[model samples]
Target chain A: MSSHAGSVQAGQIQRHKLVDRLYHWVMAVCILTLLATSLLPIIGWKFAWLAIHWVTGLVLTVAVLFHIVRALFFQKPMSMVVDGQDLQNLGSGGRPGKYNLAQKLYHLAIAVLILSGIASGLVMLRKIDTPWWRRDPYWFSDSSWGVIYSAHDFVAMSLVTMIIIHVYFALRPDEWHLTRSMFRGWITPKEYKDHFDPKRWNAEEEA
Target chain B: MIVKDIMAPFELYQPAQLKDAFSLLDSFGKDAWKMAGGYDSLDWFKDRIVRPQAVIDLTGIAEMKGIKETPDGVEIGALTTLSEIENNPIIKAKYRLLADAVSHVASPQIRNHGTIGGNASQNARCLYFRYGLPCYRAGGNTCFADTPEGINREHALFGADRCVAVTSSDGAPALTALDAKFVLQSSSGQRVIGAEEFFVGPNVDILHLTAAKPEEILTTIRLPSAWAGKNFYFEKVADRNVWDFPLVNVAAAISVQNGAIRESRIVVGGVSAVPHRLTQVEGIIQGKALEEGTATLAGQSSTRDARPLNYNGFKIPLMASLVTRAVRNATA
Candidate 1:
């Protein structure tokens, strides 16, 4: 049931822009494809997964770089910050602004994991033949390489866990509107009033 | 360039005598790995992390294989399995802290297969070091665990020079607390050193964890009667009860007279490259009554010099609490 009495109408508030939506979906697809290509081979599947894995890794890395630049230069960075008030609100179940504490934490965790994966993945690319360079395993000592591999492997597994939790939350019945906003780039005005604090998060400012 | 996870073929020598083992070591030089229990050696071989030309099996040396009661104390051979020391009646009676500490190592399976000497001489347990990462302990120029984002929750909080890997042996601190002496033998001669002095820190030598030379072998561990029958306390806090090394382990043998401590030997492991003896804490607690105030004070002052790494700052508090607990347990 809609709680708002007047002024704001339904389906008029923008939650995400078109470029942000495209970036989100593109990154999601790349992550899923990377996971499949990297993990399927580990589980005894027979296929040429290396080339696909590396190529998709490069794409994901580029997408992450693009997102970082876009968020820093074009977006209001403080909107996503989980400050002291956000943490206090998390305990009290107070109304969130643009993102809740849990959402911010998930985003931060995903960002860390992906950045670590990209760094280690880039180092690992030196070990395999690519269009740009020949395979050079001796760039680092065995032990140094071991650290890279361990970091890369750790990030991969952590992303799997984070994504599982993410997808599970996205598929919930009540949270479907938020998920739909990622695709349609907007939410109903009723959802804006229902889920967010207008004082903390101004829709006009976001627009 | 090297493909790991496959054991390369190497020559094996089972020397029945100490002299023969020394000869094999001399012949192989630095290319030989002294195999006592094959606990640490096997993993290195399996991973191709260490490829020795010859493996000098000290298991064949009969003289280095049992526990015997000496006139002043007890002498435990270097090749004695952890399980043997854990189950020995004499060790349990006289130096129960050693037995208790040995019991906390890895698991029953590892205890059965692992020897006390091997445990004492084991390498750094840092994942980077173990995986043959080019860390300072592995003859590299840098310590991988010293980085801002390094996975070093199990690293050292004290005496970390260029290497942050900790001393992982559970038996070392116990022996140090008991004021034991390590008997080392080589082709040239035999020498005895204090148990506390046996372990070398990263500052002294990052390449080797012990004072024993490449030619020498740890022949015996002498537990003197000084701290043997004292009020003993040993505790190991690990990630798991069954199969894990300690995050911080404490061993204390305190001599109390009229509820006041006459003397105490306290050693902490897993917080440094060697078993760190808290001489300052010992001094502070001497002649003081073993009470809550003294224990708490001892705990508070224990971490005065601890310099924890990026992910191991928790170890400072953990080590301090353990020392406090050990002092309190001694009162109990």
Candidate 2:
């Protein structure tokens, strides 16, 4: 049996090279680790997880900042944003994009969650005279970091929800290859043609 | 690393010429499948449902490319990407319905890669096939969709017998309604099948939906110039606004004379195994002023043949409503 059934032309597009794949997987692990650590405090797990959470949060904050800077400086920003063609597809009923409809939505959601988590974590730190982090010790007696803590929990919950959906879809058999595509870098030529460029084969045939 | 282990084994053949490609298809037959944009094909292959021995890559062939305006009609090479078609000025002005249909296929990236031929030849996006389950359509012993009750909503309203997968391709209905011809090439020779006859029914073979033989390649699509003056429209309803296939879609091309319907063609996709051409409904509207009563009657006639599935009974009324809306829009 041939694997190319239902695919368009033969040559595959190298979406993510080996270096990109390593970066993506490493980033996934770091994000997951951060989520787990942050969730402990919100769901009332033992406070020990708080120590681990803070450590991972610090690591994740640095990593995210690095990623943002790298993407801005090295990667093409146009690829991430919804383009004119994307709007056309949304209007018609076409396939979304490389990241696709769900992926794009999730990307934005996670970015917001990460930013909120870091911002709130920074504010909760005592001796930091940041504008939003300012807290009068007497106002909230039991919890000096009440507002910051609550904001952190809320963003954490939202991040968890988004991650759950993302993982669920990723693990689903129908979408298994889509998740795998990140790791493999090279999808089957068939997949590259259908999902990426129909004309790839067309020009080949003509030549 | 884990993903590479699961990758299926296959040989890729890139034929730099249409003649060479046709010869390959002739030799390989069903064992060799053609790859277009890889959008639909790759997804199906990944699911392990469709496995061909060799993929005949048409991308390298020069003869299979290009979109040009001939004196007779517009010649759209089968490999013309949806994005190209959407941006083509001649197509935009002459056959807006074709442009409209291509515009709604998947996403910008998908449009960039997906070809018109691939879209037209795409298989039914049935739940059973998509989920990797064996059903009657896939040559299994049982019809999972059929039960003690006998008929289901997803079953074909017109030509279904054993299987009831909907024709999920968006381009067919619009092109069919606009009166297009598909130019097919094979090692034996070349032939043209009207867009209407391109899709076969269960009556021919319950397992297959298209009339094209495995050895045959769809080369070019030819659309009549007469359709230029006709008003065209396509509408689809889905679960959400983005990334969902149509629950039901309607495409209409009509010519009105003196405030009455002169000639009209209406087709519905996502509701049946093939583009269900509403000839009876078209007949009803001919020479009549397309008013609310006429539109409602036309809509009622459209679904007279529908054989709704267990989960898709809503399609009957939904199809009726769509036809009504299409008629109203064409007239207005």
Global CA lDDT of candidate 1, please? 0.86
Any runs in candidate 1 off by more than 4 Å, and if so which? Answer: A1-207, B1-4
Instruction: Give the clashing residue pairs of candidate 1, or none.
Output: A143-B132, A143-B133
Q: What stretches of model 2 exceed 4 Å from their correct place?
A: A1-207, B1-5, B148-155
DockQ, all models: 0.01, 0.00
lDDT of each: 0.86, 0.72
Candidate 2 lDDT, tens digit per residue, A1-207?
234533223465546555556666776787777677655533433223434555666777777787788768876554567667667777886654455655666777778887988887765543222235432233333344556667877887787778789889989987766766666655666665566544322323322
After superposition on all C-alphas, the RMSD of every candidate to the true structure, in Å, is: 21.3, 28.9
TM-score of decoy 2: 0.59
- Tens digit of per-residue lDDT, candidate 2, span B1-332: 11311437788999888888888887887789888878777876776666788988887766767788887788899999989999999888888888887787767788888899888888777666556655656754334454434444444555554556778777889889988889988888989989767876644444656767777889999888878757777887777665667778889998888878899999998877788899989998899886788788888888886665556788888889999988887632
Candidate 2, residue B54: Cα displacement in angstroms equals 1.2
Point to the candidate with the largest lDDT: 1
